[model samples]
Target: MADQAEKLRDMVDKKKKADKTHKVIAVTSGKGGVGKTNIVVNMAMLLSGIGKKVVVFDADLGLANVDILLGIKTKYSLIDVIKSGKKMSEIMIKVNDNLSIIPAGNGVEDIANINEPSFNKVKDELRSVVKDIDILLVDTGAGISRKVTFFLKSSEDIIVVATPEPTSIADAYAMIKIMFLNYKKENIKIFVNMAKNENEAVSVYENINKICKNFLKKEFKSAGFALYDKKLPLCVREQKAISEIAPDGKFSVSMKKMINNIFKENVKIYDNPVKRFFSSIFGG
Candidate 1:
């Protein structure tokens, strides 16, 4: 009996250690048209370029376009995986050996409204695939709706992208405030996009961080920034990742710097991130 108990304990320990590979990084914003999805797709491509297994989970129910941005078409998505009971492996679009994308389906169904059984089944399906990836980059919808917040609150690494526009900055603050005041999520990160220069990017982040420090007593980590690149819009129109088409472009360079900075930080990892993410969303 003691030997059997020891074996069971060992099995549990092995499972916990294996589960640590599932790292969820949710990219979100307070308003639309902030280039949040672009950042997520590019980040996934860059991470996979460096030999890291990455999964781009498009959780943006309002605008699920990660598949479109990647120029990949999918017949099934999270909706099929959850509702029709399709296998996750079937719905997942394998972009490359190191990269895969899970479309969340059309921005119609309120994923937050899913019942407990469906939620648990989805969680199980996600767990089956999540164990094989190094990072899961979730592109959440723009805004602070309940669905958006659910993903943000569940993720250990949350990157809120905001352009240098005044409205964008204000909205970014509101999003951070909601996370802090409601969920007590203090380790939020910020990425300034479309800044004119490095100084402008840092200034924008500093201003937002200062405001958060003053009001919410929380200072978000800097996920770095990108300068205004004309090539970005062109790349988007062409439906290709900037990191792929223009690997040496300003956007790609900035993204590499940001990715490196994030990796350098000693961010916390989860024992079972996939399970935790769904459980938190569904109150499991």
Candidate 2:
């Protein structure tokens, strides 16, 4: 463990001297069961299909489900990398030519309660994997735990997934409020999942946006809505992306638009937000 930690430190030191910029986007939710991971997976496929290099980090840690949804069997996870001195590249399971994923194995509580040194080690190991990547989408676990907030703080943009349910809306607002108070992050985006239609999706976004503006004094960009489709569950069962199962489906069309809006927006990508994120957490 000590030797691996020392190696990680050396790698991080070298990474700091290199020049690279990767957009770190965190896709999270206020509560579980909101289909956040599915969005992350499909969105990654869409981004990759558009010629962008994408790497997904399943930051949910113990409760990771990205690999399962992708139908890929990972031999090693982030936990293995931390405990067994495995390389990050060794654990990465390539989903396609443009996309790869870092699975977080189950029962790994250490990642959720990571300390400064542990966080640094993990970040260092990830530096090479993320170098020159176009986007690094972190599928953070739901809720406002210390682990969740830490990932959010480190990300350049956050996409909060929510449904049209009142409970989901309330929880989503709660998450936005906490993020504003804690990190003062303004580059937040909203993607309405499981909506019945465009109106339902817009209504969900408006409700949350109004609350954020009136109460929290913050706003969120609409990444668009994914209509509730019966085929989605079947696709999930098959461990295939919606685009792969039903490319002409409404969900696939919606996701394509979401990807379009994401790149169309003239947002600024900061330099090494991952390093800054760790520094903020560790008080370095």
Candidate 3:
């Protein structure tokens, strides 16, 4: 009986160690103005608030905004990592002891600045940084640029933030369809933003779900959604996180529960944020 007890203890220890594997969750949107960046920031804060180490990479490239939203000013961007041959770790700025951010570097001009070789270097470096962190949230640029699409396809959990507007839903569907046609990974988890309430959010999701099921024959696994709330805008205005500024806010509380739910299901939020770019782009 003593030997059996020791064996059980050993198994428990191993499981605990294995739980440290890091993940990179990319907050994506089909259209701009859907509050993807805010979602990314708040989620990162939630992870950090609970003692998880997180790295938020503002990969908006040319139009990066995570810095402005968080009121963080970075002296370097990913450009330095490729041009100067500096490690990704060197560019990451510690927002707090447990949270860090890699801002987009400037000075690299023109489309020629970002190429296949350069991007691979960036992705590899991102992989290295995320290796030591519990969660890495990437804030990608809006729209379907080759660069943006690459990161979206690379993410393990693609949290599509869409509003109830026709354009938002249409664009969301467009992005999802692209993923299906190109990457062939049909299961996408959506996070609807700015709905009137939970019922409205669910209604929006159901519409998307019905269309995918009937037409695309695809299944969308929902991560969850946030209702339209004044607190979100207020939080942004104050340069504070929703979870922090208004911890008891309706959207904030719902998001917290959603984060916990994602964890309990073993559904990682961080890993595979578009690890494969080329195949998802022109390959299909």
Candidate 4:
């Protein structure tokens, strides 16, 4: 009786402690090969570089590549959290002093198989797992999948990454459409990655913006863009993040600006949601 009571009390105390902190951000895209995982890994590193405690959760099932990009394979992944039946903390890997990662190991098919009860359990536990971190970044898979929507709706910020291809534009627009159809459009954020210039980026955002504005009767929540930098692909081939590759590079500067904007806009949303909403609506 004493042991059981003590165990119960300890569990409750730990749960309470883990429930106190965490901001969840989901990185998504309509199409693949647009540097989605690359952006995620680098962004997490940048935030950690700026003294924030961040954890990048590789939630992309089957085609997971964040681990490959980082060159740090893990012993366990979210699969273990779902199937090996370990607590969220058990499968985590500390990538840096301020940043940790939870990868997708084998048996990832199980993550998609989670039913209502299991999903509820996972959600409750993941919220607890992230409470200690300042930001919890979830790297979702490319294109539309049931698992993709699941995380997008749950995230505090959903980052839509895409490029300049005609297909990418259509898919990007389709992605925003799907989100608007499924939930409130105000919470979804879009990032145009690998563009040629500010003009090109705006053109891409404008193309998608016009559609969402006219047909959906919704507005984009927030927008930031990354221009094409040759250093990007080269660094990825070396299995290093962009900032690690060239901190002074053009792409790095733009990315940091975008991230800083994200942090600022985060605080601005509550104090000035209307202004931000309009600016995003107008591509300002």
- Badly placed stretches (over 4 Å) of model 2 are 1-20, 109-111, 265-284
Models 1 onward score TM values of 0.83, 0.84, 0.85, 0.82
Ordered list by TM-score, greatest first? 3, 2, 1, 4
RMSD of each: 10.3, 12.6, 10.1, 9.1
How do all the candidates rank in terms of lDDT, highest first? Answer: 2, 1, 3, 4
lDDT of 1 by residue, 106-214 (tens): 7655664666676567657877888877898989988888667766777878889988898999999999999889888867899999999889999999999998999
Q: Residue 5 CA error for candidate 2 (Å)?
A: 47
lDDT of 4 by residue, 1-284 (tens): 99999999999999977754677888888988887788789888888887788988887875677877888878877766666678878878888899988787644556665666665666776887776788988998888887777777888888888788989888888888888796764577778888888899888887877778898887785458888999888887888887777765656766676787887622122124565476478753
Model 3 per-residue lDDT tens digits across residues 66-162: 7777878788777778788889998888878889988885444553248888888888998888876788888887777788888877887777778
In candidate 1, what residue range of length 10 has the lowest lDDT sum? Answer: 264-273
Flag regions of model 1 displaced more than 4 Å.
1-20, 107-120, 265-284
Look at candidate 2 and give me any clashing residue pairs. none
Indicate whether candidate 2 or candidate 3 has the larger TM-score.
3
lDDT agreement with native, every candidate? 0.83, 0.84, 0.77, 0.77
